[model samples]
Target: MIWRVATLSFLLTLSYLCFQPVKMEDGKEESMELGTQSQSQMDTSDSQNKGSNEVEEKNPSVEKSGEMKPDKTESDSGSKPTNNEKSANKTPEENMVEEKKSEKTVELKFPTTLEGFGYKFDEDGKLGDIETGEPFVFKVRSHDDSYNQKRYEALGEVITEYVYELLEKEANLKRVHIPVDASEGEAQSFIFMTEDALTNPDKLLLLIHGSGVVRAGQWARRLIINDNLKSGTQLPFIKRAVDSGYGVIVFNTNENRIRQGDKFIPVRESSTAVDHGLYVWEEFVSKSAARNIAIVAHSYGGVVTVELAIEKEAEFKERVFAIALTDSVHSLSHQEVSSSVIKLFKRIAKNWVSSKEPLDTPVPSRHRYECPQVSAGTNKHEETSWSSFESIFEMLDKAYKEVTEIDKEEL
Candidate 1:
């Protein structure tokens, strides 16, 4: 009877342990009814979120244990959702903006270094063709002024170097660095010249570009960006000069900053446009052995030439035979040029000013003491040099013939 009683007690205890409500995995002793209520609340939350554009709706699924969990909707094959499926609710404008952002992120990424831009100087300090095949667009965000300015500055420096290389390769010109100031210690400005420029050529063509960011061989960077390189660079003029048997000298007037290590220092002596012009005229143009020198000055370059004439009147009168200007900003009164120099300049020089009139048509002079003004065939400031290119060569030819005829008569 005792054994029978013990067995019955053991059986009852085992049944109680096995059948008692098991604690949820969540450590809460919630009933099945409570779990069902929680799932119902999650479904209601999801439905409410779907109505608000600001709220993101989440997929809810009930686990085997009857607990609600956030779930991702997948295909029967268990594949992830496509980008199209994920962005299905986006508006057309939003989709277009997103696509543009994606494209900019991927395609518009640019390198921050010179070599990364596919330009490298060789052992001889000469750059070869760009290997990366990247177009130099100079495109920057308009909202960021300071950042874009710095970027444009860096790009301008690299473009100057590339143009220097082009002058050597395409135009068959040699680079000559003349010291502008001995006090500044190695402060010098370079110029491009033909091989026979200093070897006593009969006629010399001095090509002087405008002020600002333009260097020795560039007419306008804007044209390089918007138009073709042939219209933007001085190679066409150099080629024409060579074909006409004239030695070319391309002056580097705007290189007022020299690179030292990784930083740029101001070339104080040649810093100002007039100072650079004076120094180059004294050190380079006067030193050349060419007999008849003609100047093709553009914009501030015309001002430089005027200053040159004022400073070196004797040498100017003796050698400089003709001056062809394109949109010159020369001011005889502002520059304090002498009356005698002004009269001589007026006789020898002609300006191709930007105007809407026909090419080479006479335009009324804008300044009191100025050269004869003629239309450049274009109304744009930067387009003047290129548009007046053919007319300029013709003027040079006529001047050379007239000057040589006078010289022969004197002989």
Candidate 2:
């Protein structure tokens, strides 16, 4: 009777435990319907706001020279046309006017609009939606005027700054401001590096873009602002370097001044391209512990590197390993390169120029003074950046390996 009573009590306890309610973190016993309820709430919210999101996506932000195109009218389009569908020759106004001239005047047929694209047909038949009747903030280059130069300069400034933002966000690179010639608490300019590139020394890849409007992380401003992001920015170069166990530093050799609050302060160390590049090299690059350093410079950047090789003779001999130039504009006319320097440079540097010539067709030796050039497998000057990427890395690898081997042999 005792065993029977104990067994019955144990079965009752097990049944009670199995049927107990589930408690939440807040100690409230929630209904099994809570999950379904939450899901239903999500479905309802998404359904409610889906239209607005679609409307926002339809309103594209596209403009050339900040010209406020008259808001498109219902009569202007039979159906909303995409960039590809639109006529190449017709203006937006002309397209609308064409749409208004219907073949059957007696029967007016209103075309159905795409979802989210709203066209307001006011009583006046004019476009109801309009942009601010304002000109672009600055004038860009035109065939007719010189005042447009400032506008071009401003555009370059905007592009260079935007490129920096993309580099950090897209490539996840870090920025460090190295004081140009000033001591602590004085004026400084910036250079970009990877997370620990400054401290780690294994392999360092320094990226220097061409002169003029293009700043660090870009080869051309027009492509960056006008073309696709991948074609414009140096994110590709950064990623490749990171993958190859190389720390990267994007040199801002052209930014001679920095903004402080409302006023702009000139860097004490840098006033020109040569000044800035030399300052960055002496202060930051010279201090790195990397056994070898490689550089990828484009266009006028080649000239800057050539100057560095000429000026910093001892430092270049000790630390530099490889240098690649895309469509380099380095010339003997600008400054003379000694025979000894040419011999030192030819061993590691390869100039990739925009030409129809073979990739290895040597630039005619100019009295053995100027650096020899090679075709980067492209003829377009601006396209050299994108075209020479593969060739640049190949040269860097071969030269870098040779450098490492020599160091090992010495060891």
Specify the highest-TM-score model's number: 1
lDDT by candidate, in order shown: 0.66, 0.58
Cα deviation of 76, candidate 1, in Å: 36
lDDT of 2 by residue, 242-292 (tens): 999888889877677778888888887775566777887888778877767
lDDT of 1 by residue, 288-405 (tens): 8889999998777887788788779999999989999987666665566788888987888999977778899998865778778899987666678889999999999999999999
Prediction-by-prediction clash tally: 0, 1
Task: Specify the poorest-scoring 10-residue window by lDDT in model 2.
Answer: 41-50
Q: What TM-score number comes out for model 2?
A: 0.60
Query: Quick one: best lDDT, which candidate?
Result: 1
lDDT of 1 at 274: 64
Structure candidate 1, residue pairs in collision: none
